[model samples]
Target: MHNSIERTPIRAHLTDHMVIVNAQAVETGPTRRPAAVLIWSTTDQKIAFSDPKGNLLFEGKAALVAPEVIRRLRTTDSTFFSLNFEPGNRHFLPLSRLVARQDFMPLKFDRFSELSDELQSRFELADYKGIEELSDELALTLLPRTNAKHLRDERIDLLLPLLESNQPPELNSLAQMLHLSKDRLSHLFADDIGMPLRSYVLWRRYRRALLALQSGEKIATVAHRVGFYDHAQMSRTFLTLFGYSPSILKCPKFIRISGIQSN
Candidate 1:
């Protein structure tokens, strides 16, 4: 099994709701991500995931892993794609339900084969618009069409902008603004957003930092702008959540990052 990060350039597509990475090869050590991740082999080869101790957890063409599930991926020379959904994204709740509290769930390829092929082609061509459209379609295909309703809560809606801002409100301040006790607000947020409020806030900060770094902002500047106390803190968070040090961004040969253009 390959044990080091692939040296070939990988493509990364980023948006507010999700991130898509397409790679020709990958071998990651144990990683526990903050957002839900769906990984599949584009060449239809089976990928192997194992625990830190080398115990086999899953072997399949595709798998949806829940947030905070630690696993390592090892694959042969097959093309691979991964889609990561932020906790507060519209598609997150539906996808989480599919996992249903399990560490990981295997998915059938017949349903996603055609769409995945198109998405991989778009990625290779760097077609951002096509990539965005196909990503939503692929997400929808994974969900139960009959039950895919947009989840909205007015209270939660009011809080999102504030949390995404440079100076996010404290939990107590947010609770007061929503006119609910702290505990009540927390529960309501979890129900509507599919994650606790604190986790969502951290994710927002991380997302913002990632975008800034991709645009060539210095690490320390990004840390301060995104509410981290210092560059070290931000780097540590990046390592924990993404399984890589933020310093990796300095090497342009490793990956190419692009964001979806706003409509």
Candidate 2:
């Protein structure tokens, strides 16, 4: 008989405005690890994600993802609990990298058709505490140096800073400065990051919009400030991302991102 495997805690990146909690639980034998949980702004709900932790996490490492179609991994059956984090985009990761995945599967970790055993084990569990640590570990570990893709790195670098700017710049300008065609830029983004540039842009913007709302801004004002099309636009994206409306997440209301609100 084999002894049970135990995992330590990991780190996660965070915004001054937002907080991220890592996945925590213990399960045994093949079980579904929790995917991502996104909480958008105040609308109907935010679009929760279960994708690759984004390209930033796969920087300069030689890790492995479970392949494209494998989907989520099954927790050891002996006894294992999980602690899931929230609010990020969704992407399919190979065993080289560690990321949150969805339920849809032919579950896999390392090589497919070889589960209910020890094959796909990649995350650096240091100390299971909070979000900042998890985000940091993720950023540091997953995103190592792959190759010389300055533009790709540069583009991703823009995100944290751009979001911090008082008046964040638009995408077209960045594309222009990079001296690359729009399609080409998008292609590079997808290549390095997995998802298209526009998709991450949306996630980044929506994250900001939610922050504004959390600060007690009006719907219209928050929408305008965060560069949304309008309140309706914010509302729709909120619902899409969080699975709840914007008005509900207010501080006093204090809505939890995990629950499903009834009509």
Candidate 3:
């Protein structure tokens, strides 16, 4: 049997810290993924998840695959578009809801055609900044009004850039700077973000590692730059987070939304 090849030209757009990739596959292929993925396909693509030994776990058209899932794809030529979310970002509210479930969650929505059209146009035109603006607006609308004090105290909105930087400020230092006790700092992070601070740091490091690897950096260089102890440590973290070693990863081409100038 011939390997299912990615036939159509694949394009990616980054918006709201999410990477959306559009591709059409001509046949079935086996591949490993490192992060959680949500697929919205124009057609019901035949997708499957299996164990390392290839035991089928799930199959469907639309899937929400958790991090480190080894999946096999089997499908005809179809519009298979997917979004890769940066972990620990609560802004991905719609997609985050599915994280608590199994690695793969199948979905069916009749309105997918309309949604796909809008998304396809945006990606094709590389309108990521527009998408980011809309997402920000939506996030503001959804943010809880009761949490004004929390927002002010936590300052996540302001600290996001620092958090994403190569040298993330330590929580202890941040706590002292903000005049919050360590316990209060921890509580605030958990309460507002639904994740621990250390976990958030790890996710950020992993995110940077992925981006660096995509930019054609060597594994050791990426590991060091992202604050890992070494390439081995980074590889271990990568395997744990993505279910595949970085060696097997083939980074996709993407247009970073942050790189685009706002219109």
Candidate 4:
């Protein structure tokens, strides 16, 4: 018998604060995830997660992982679904509450199992809106009473737009505009956004590049337009944010993206 795993196209639904991904037999090496994520196996098959030293961490049907956790995922032949929530997402605070500031937390998969078939069918049919609705339902099921208030800070709100431009303002200038010292601004941003200001800026640039790529622009053009130093730099950033290289886009047959937009 052949020992190779048969891989399928990766289907993903992307929004400013959330991303839903479905894939089969995909594996990732130890890497620090930039956002909190909920993962479950669609086939009722077991999935394994390990630390950087390859020490067994968890082997189960579902898991909730805190952001910045360095771990490896071993899916083997199982189909899996994942929900990634950005730090600033409204659901993030609630979800983080579940993790209790830990690296991993096992989750009951009863709800996920019930909806797995329908979610898989929707992805195959390219029903993005349906996918979004169903994913939201799953999220609510996992985190009940999730109608939490959104994080708001006028200073961070003002800083967000400045970071969108190809030539974002320096941190010193941004603090000046906010009428605060740079140290104060940095602390405020971290407290409000749940991430460092510099990291968020880089994530914004990476997101802009993804949107440009979705429009079928050349890598070099997208890199330049998104404020990356060059193609090589952009590729490196892509790999850092995503476990895979940006070259994976070359195989459009193996990738499907929907509802991707700028923040």
Prediction RMSDs, each to the true structure: 2.8, 13.1, 5.7, 3.2
Which candidate achieves the best TM-score against the true structure? 1
Can you write out model 4's per-residue Cα lDDT over 1-263, one digit (the tens) per residue?
11212357777777766778898776665667567788999776888888767899889999888887777887877889998887667667667667766778888878688888898898878887887787667666667574566567877877777887888999999999999999999999888777898888888787677666766778888889888889999888876676655666434555666665643
Per residue, candidate 1 scores C-alpha lDDT tens digits across 1-263 of 34334466667788777888887666666777766788888776888888879899999998888877888878777878888887777888788778867778988877666677788778778787888777777777778769758668899988887887767889999999999999999999998887788888877787777767766778898889888889998888887776666777545676677784311
The alpha-carbon lDDT assigned to residue 215 of candidate 4 equals 67
Give the per-residue lDDT of model 3 (tens digit) for 124-143: 67787765554344344333
lDDT of each: 0.78, 0.38, 0.58, 0.76
Which of candidates 1 and 2 reaches a greater TM-score?
1
Best by lDDT: 1
Compose the digit string of candidate 2's lDDT tens values, residues 1-263.
01212333312223332234222222112212223322111111111213332212121101122323212122222222112232222222221134335222221222211211121122232222333333334433333366232233556555535544435556676678667677776676666555555555565666666556656668888887767778998777766654345775444333222211111
lDDT of 2 at 106: 22
lDDT of candidate model 4 versus the reference: 0.76
Return the clash pairs for model 1, or none.
Answer: none
Ten-residue stretch with the least lDDT total in model 4: 1-10
Find the 10 residues in a row with the least total lDDT in model 1.
1-10
Clashing pairs in 3: 34-242, 68-242, 68-243
